[model samples]
Target chain A: MEKCKKNRKLIWLTIYNELSSEQKSQLEIHLQACSDCQSDYEEALRLRRALDEKIQVAPTAAQLEASRAELHQRLLLLSQPRLQKSWFDKVWQIVSLDFAPSWRFATAVALLTFGVLIGNFYSRKAATEYNFYQQQISELLESNISNIESVTYDPVTRQVAIELNTLNDFTIQGNIEKPEIQQLLAHSIVVRYQNLSIRKKIPESD
Target chain B: MGNEEELLIRRAQRGNLKAFEDLVKRYDEKIMRLIFNMVSDAEDTRDIYQEVFLKAYQSITNFRFASEFYTWLYRIAVNTCINFRKRKTIVQHDSLDSYLDGNNDNWQILNTSEIRNPEEQLINKELSEQIQKSIDRLPARQKSVFVLKHYHGYKLSEIAVIMNCSEGTVKNYMFRAVQKLKISLQGYQQL
Candidate 1:
């Protein structure tokens, strides 16, 4: 004889099925020897019969229709588009800075990286250009002031030259030829003209 | 109802509204009855039954022919009933007096001939009712297993899928449910 282990659960399930002829014989042999399994099987059939009676019950047809209608309406309501958001959705959107679909996430990351790179490059170029312009302006101003201080011999030329420097480099150009120097030059020219007048006595060549 | 249910599920999954409506017409009663058995409240059972079907409708798109349509529907019904019961704190208990009175009265009407009194019928009904009470007293999971298995004729594997449990777990539940019911129906043969 094969070792027929009595699996209690297998016996319980077998009670409900159309047992094979051999399985029926086996069950009979087992039941004849095992009172516990037999009683369990009998109780299961009794409980099933009771449940079947309960299932035979019917409700009013109108109530059934009403339930269907009500549920249909409820489902429709749920299906309708309404502004529903998760409570934390906005907060997450603000704080996350990384929420997107897979493709969109990748695109957004690429765009952000591109933006940062462009911004950094432009800012560095602008700073370098600004420093260069400051150096050029300072050099121009220094050269204009030095030119004014060094001008001396021709007074009329000096005025015209100073005027040109002031017009071109007004920021640092200033008056450097002194008034006393102008007056001395004017007086020396006058004395020379007077000595020539005394030597020739009849001065007019009218 | 069975064939029509199968056909409607097939056609509904294919996007046939008329077929789905016909299916609803066919099963509307049984669906309500099953929910009523689980929940016991008229309003709640009715609502749950409708919601179960609506869910079935919406989820028909995801449904595959892995199991019988009614099996899938039964899963929806059972889950909806369980959720409804949990949310509303509703529990079903055995109606002992109603069971006894209803059975005795029906028998009295059927057995018009006093000479042929079928006393065994009454005893059988009582025995079955006591067993039902024992099933009722079992924990919710065990009771559902007992109902799905013994009443609905669901296979263990089907029950496992519907209940979302391992087959071994379903077997364990059925085993314990049967053991408790057998003890509760003690002296049933003498009844």
Candidate 2:
């Protein structure tokens, strides 16, 4: 049963006559004893004959000729060299007297140079304007230092001393969870510390 | 592979349009038949026919003479057809009855004068239609394999080369295609 089951699939190849000589002999031996396989083979052969009767429909000669002609035209176009302006035509266009080419070239260069000069002037002006705005912002930030008790700059040590006044004059030290201290520290960093040129400092008791 | 064909190929490779056209003429009929058998739609077949030759002409310079010119050409035709089938979203199912009723444009060509008896003609037409439908129902790869094998009479090895698959794989496809065709065509065997 196992052998017949496997041989059933080969029935197609057998009907198509694609089996090797040895396999064909083996299958022939199997077919002599196996009525079921024989019937399957017969069915496959019938199907093959039906498939063989299919008429190969060719395109009409007219269609073929039309396609050939179209393809030929397309191929001709593909093979043909591209149309280009001749060197004489290019030179004539460039040297044509309606507009003097040299004067046009000079005008183009002058315009480009003037455009570059104006672009450079505007860029420098914009940079200066940006610096001025930055300076104003720094001064504006400095004005928000109301809680800072005093700011002393030491030239010898190259340090700026910043003293802060608490609301109750009590030194409040805690974690970053303290909102007031966090706000004060943020303001000090953004305003005084960012702009000041300070290196090292030590608090002095007064 | 003939000396004359070789000369033509050389000339075609050298950009001789006449030589290329001659090559097209030599194989266009068979190629058209093969494509039409694979794709029953006349319009799609015509488009693929034109595309195959145009592609061959465009890429003639790349012909390295590694295989027969026809095999190389068949590769292009098969690939183009496969891609064309893939690009299409709707499958065009041609009804054989409608086609045989003189509605199809190619009906006149298919209905040759060989069969004078109307009854026999009808039977033959139905059988052919059944066969085509079976072939059409196959998956694309199996369809190509079956068409190339049975319709074109190409050997399995040759089919493998044209399909760019192993011979075993081609045989497997052929087996599955034939099995499907057998089951689909079981009722028509007595006729």
Candidate 3:
């Protein structure tokens, strides 16, 4: 009849080692009337006492010392390898373990690399542009020298007299219209001097 | 309680190996017994015993005086047993029937009033071994609590500190363990 109860397992554990004095008296009174629960109580007590009396056997001293030595050796091995490593090596290992470069750190580094590349690209582009301008200035200076050396010019005022004093022939000429040539030569000198002044200013920008 | 042991512990925490070995010598027996009562294998007991002291040796520098040294050692023993239980796939082996020196050589008189005969004496020995098997069969936490409470005679509060649990939890584990042990050993009565 007691076996059909749902909480019988829990009840068995409850009465395994514990019962109040009143509960014990009550159980005793009930056991006197019932043979089944009496057998249950006796069996339970027997099991409990057997477990209580179970003794703990001690370890042999030899075995104890041997095991201790073996364990110490194992720990010593684990602690040994790192001792030979330099401080930098240890720091690197620790940093690698603890603060690995996550996606965020990688992204930051990648962005930094990208920025440096862009800056270098712009700097190289500016250097090439400056060089190109310098080459243009040198070509302009060479053109100015060819024009000045091919024409007869006054060395003091640095004027090009145009065809009026051509360096091709030095003989005196007759029947040449001198006044018209002088007007034309005067205008060519003014234009050539102005162009030379403008060409000279271009070198200052270099 | 010895001044020399106290001095050794202090020196061990300062990274002295000789002092650590001295501390190991002092508590090795007690720690071995504490582990033996759990696994009950001489070989495994020796293994766990070594691990406990080795752990103490390795971490001694970090040992603060937060608790008694013995308590700290006991905690290490319990933890090693628990970890051993986890790493081990299965702990059940054949019985110690062949191994026990059963020549009736060292049978001390156990409670002369209760013991009856050689047959009863044999039954007692078998019963003790059966109880040990039943204890090994317990869940790891329950077995640890029961061993600490029953064999080592630790207070529930003391066990709580070592186990890093509440006293109520320790007592509850002990209760459940005892109940389970009772049921498991009941099968032996038929033998």
Question: How close is chain B to the truth by TM-score, in each candidate?
Answer: 0.68, 0.87, 0.83
lDDT of 1 by residue, A25-109 (tens): 7777887777777775666666554444432334555566667677667656655668877869865664465455665677667
- Single out the weakest 10-residue window by summed lDDT for candidate 2 chain B: B102-111
TM-score of each: 0.52, 0.65, 0.54
Model 3 chain B scores worst on lDDT over the 10 consecutive residues at B102-111
Task: Name the top TM-score candidate.
Answer: 2
Going through the candidates in order, what fraction of the true interface contacts does each contain?
Answer: 0.22, 0.58, 0.33
What is the full ranking by DockQ, best candidate first?
2, 3, 1
* Per-residue C-alpha lDDT of model 3 across residues B8-73, encoded as one tens digit per residue: 989988777767777787778778778777776666776677677777877887777777788888
* Model 2, position A194: C-alpha lDDT score: 64
TM-score of 3: 0.54
Ranking by lDDT: 2, 3, 1
Task: Give the higher-DockQ candidate: 1 or 2.
Answer: 2
Give per-residue lDDT, candidate 1, residue A98. Answer: 43
lDDT of 2 by residue, B1-119 (tens): 89999899999999999999999999998898888877787778878888899999989889888878888899899889888888987767455565455555543345365556778
Comparing 2 with 3 on DockQ, the higher-scoring candidate is 2
